[model samples]
Target: FEAGLLETLAPLAGVAVEARVASAPAEKTRKARFDEAMLFTHRGLSGPAILQISSYWREGEPIVAAMAPDHDVFEVLKAAKAANGRQAVHTALSQIVPRRLAENLCAREGVAGNLADLSDKALRRLDQAVNAWTVKPVGSEGYRTAEVTLGGIDTAALDQQTLAVKSVPGLYFIGEAVDVTGWLGGYNFQWAWSSGWAAGQVC
Candidate 1:
């Protein structure tokens, strides 16, 4: 267990591949493809996907996490079983996700041995773990780890083009100080540069 933990940054790395906030039942049941990687930490979960979703995440909110975002987990695994029933479950799963991740899932779920040994119910359980896993975070890692805050000055109160305060002629609100928050990566930076440039142009 010690060696396994040391080998992976996320103990449940592959299991939480792509995650987004799920505040409602419909949202939780729906499928989504996150264009970012999700990482598992001892604290909870993090990564581009989780980080982007964090802005919408509230305390006590549950997140819908997908292990295999690209394929239908039930049908895909069933097909693999039909083609190679004698193959280990982890072997088949590794073909869908990362090998290390498959191994972790297999160990956690007690899913091992040949695919032929697995019943339809077992297959469904495996599919759910990969496609529709639900996770409820205690809370976020907080501002210390937060890349951006959600709101500041209301966008409506400012000039949309110049980012200048509508009521105050010389005052301007820009960057993270405004109510505009963007996705992770260079998006926020780009907004900063663009908004700063716009504000500078007229201020």
Candidate 2:
């Protein structure tokens, strides 16, 4: 049995092939835990916003993205007033998000206390915070569970027209495998389509 095993392995022993393995260095891979909430200012997600921001994510940095719209607190207050008509604007805003979040936001805007006590100035502040609520995301789930990887093959190594590797011929990469990643909405899909189309046309 030993002779037969050696005989079978003889052919494999002579085979030589180069194996390329890529891994993040220990320092680059080490993860730091962060406890903070990430916030977005717009009305929930408008599709591509999250994706665009994530495309620029860097390792080791605590992820917190925010946007403040031009309109201030008064806008939110007025809108709330219109929606609720006679109902309290703060009460109306509270119904949209968690009661606790609403309360905190209102408090930060000095619109807390009793709804009856809300002044025009306080209402304005509430409106601004809501419309431009400084989102604080309590960190992301980390790279292990991330949906899309941000960086990869540098674009400088690929031909913009054909997406062919400058150094390697008949070798092409596209989609998430490549460096270019689209925004969360349909941007990624568009990148897939474009990159795939380029490679298909060339290769």
Candidate 3:
């Protein structure tokens, strides 16, 4: 990291700094690997939707797994409507999700009957339920297994131009310790680059 322009600007900006010695690594601790699979009734896992929601994690939180009957039933309904144009959508959906989920959704919507007996009104209601199924997350595995943490130091305390603390000169915070957190993809790495560059310029 170069320190030409940054050193010149540090004093001019009226900033204070602090430098602390980096700590040594701690003794090795036993770690367990968890391999719990996410399960869903209708649409199978391994898609973007499931992957995106998996990123959220916190300390001591249980690992959350989700299941919904809506999509499965919805697909069945859509298939019925297009195939015979007379089959009950809800009945078809039952074959897709678990029996309990199917029964619960039907009972909640007051839909009853075989494929040939469902009315237009019943079909519409069932259709709506399937498309927007709601699921409750049982829990999520705590931070020990989490990929990332959401919050950090307040970036407002540091000067954006030099990555130095306004109250503490020479002191710089970078990487995940900073207030910045990234979305699922490459965005986080970009933040690291930009922040490190700023700090390196001055450090």
Candidate 4:
């Protein structure tokens, strides 16, 4: 929010960023949505991962994010230290994530000096920072920017084969009107097509 550097851009556009989404609070591990663009908005966060979780985002809830979910940053750093102890720690880290991110994380974590000199404990802390960065938002962007609506006529009230309301002979809820919603990568469109075709058969 301060720098305004990473706003509404793709994940691969510049500095590499791993976006993890945790819709549930009691869950052990957050659902990781990697390689997606995450934006910092006036309210909180908006992007593919944020939007996908927003469909399930409840009020007074928070979404957990991990910057690097793919690998164990601590192990990677330790391995680098064993192999090339003379090299700068940040330099070794740059190979894992984006260089800019590696540098910033290294500085923030106070991970300086030759890897051989750094303790295993310090490396573990840095690993948590890189892979377990969590954020809590006030709320989602809502209907104005939501990708798809999550609810409509209840599934129990409709005929699954034809998508016709049980009580109503002619009424049909197809496409976005039904309760089906999906993730960021064009699943809702597929739902719309299938539901429309289903209703078309009955109509």
Candidate 5:
């Protein structure tokens, strides 16, 4: 929160939702799923899920989010419909997600009235909204708030064993200044320490 970065599309601010996010088909690398806590901020989405996905995300490419990752939302909604036919759709959905998020999702899907009144198709759409919410981020906070960065000096320019600049004798580049980057965790820190140690050995 102190970083004040990674602004996303405005909608579900203040809502905390655990999601399984994955890169879109347009992603440059192999698709990997990031399951973590997602927080809706006043400007956009943040927290672990978004930060992890942002490494693979490019502008204009959509990211798929399984909001209800543990539950089959379609089946849940259908079961709710059967168990309590008179309950409102949003009311039933609130049991799965936050109440405000449920209302917003219901409004977005244009679903209302008793669960029994909703068609299977309508319920399915709502299920999609909850389980497969897709959105393209307009922009990110960039390096100002980035935990790590990509696209530094190419790794090929340096000796793999010593992290020394092969063309420039006695010169070395290590850590974030190099192209090596890792997923969200202490992997980046490990790279920093190991690379620095390698260079420290021979530099």
Candidate 6:
């Protein structure tokens, strides 16, 4: 586990979506992105995509989610409108995202009624809602449920090649104890093994 899962204050507890999510853009914040599954829990957001971006997410910043990552949402909605103008807006959106989420988003965005009644601008707004939904996370699960902790002994204090403490000759910091952190996959495990091996050679 690590200390990098996000918690949201929104009413999205039971919804899950496969989205391409990105950390908020800012001058000093490193924007992290992931295209994977995300679950809306009673407390906040979780799952692979949320966990990956949490490392780069800063407090008070909004994260962006591309709900229909593989499709052009505007085009889809427009096409749906053309195909069957009587179809409900949210119903058409459900083709892109989960049904619950589609309805929720449509409600939140103040878009409703049949697609035939919607203008090009209205469709664009729905596109933004589907493709670029941004939510500000209240906080994170912290170290308790985190996949791996983020900060550690600064890499500058250690010899990169050997993972040895530059100032303390025999001392070495490896894996999660060092400043190196990988994504949700096996990179962190590999780091632990590789760093330990590098230090083992001469330590």
Return the top candidate by lDDT: 5
- Full-model lDDT, candidate 6: 0.85
* lDDT (10s digit) by residue, model 5, range 107-160: 878899999889999999998998898877778887788988878999999899
Q: lDDT: which is higher, 5 or 6?
A: 5
Question: Candidate 3: misplaced stretches above 4 Å?
Answer: 1-47, 50-114
All models, RMSD in angstroms: 4.6, 19.2, 20.1, 4.6, 3.7, 4.0
State the TM-score for model 5.
0.91
Q: Which residue pairs come into collision in candidate 4?
A: none
Model 3 residue 112 lDDT? 72
Q: With candidate 3 superimposed using the best TM-score fit, by how many Å does residue 121's alpha carbon deviate from the native? A: 4.0
lDDT of each: 0.74, 0.51, 0.51, 0.71, 0.86, 0.85
Q: Quick one: best TM-score, which candidate?
A: 5
lDDT of 1 by residue, 126-146 (tens): 788776777666677678888
Q: Write the per-residue lDDT of candidate 3 for residues 1-203, one digit (tens) a residue.
A: 01442332232232111111111112123121222223332222223333344453222332222233224444556567667665554556656544554565576688876655666667667655544433333344447645546667788998888778899878988878887766556777888898899899868
Task: Look at candidate 3 and tell me the lDDT of residue 15.
Answer: 18
**1 against 3, candidate with superior TM-score:** 1
Model 4, position 90, has a per-residue lDDT of 82
Off by over 4 Å in 1: 1-10, 13-33
Q: Give the TM-score comparing model 3 with the true structure, all chains together.
A: 0.51
Over 4 Å off, model 5: 1-11
In candidate 3, position 144 carries an lDDT of: 62
Q: Which of candidates 2 and 4 is the stronger one according to TM-score?
A: 4
Task: Mark the 10 consecutive residues where model 5 has the least summed lDDT.
Answer: 1-10
How far residue 124's Cα lies from its native spot in candidate 5, in Å, is 0.4
Output candidate 2 Cα RMSD: 19.2
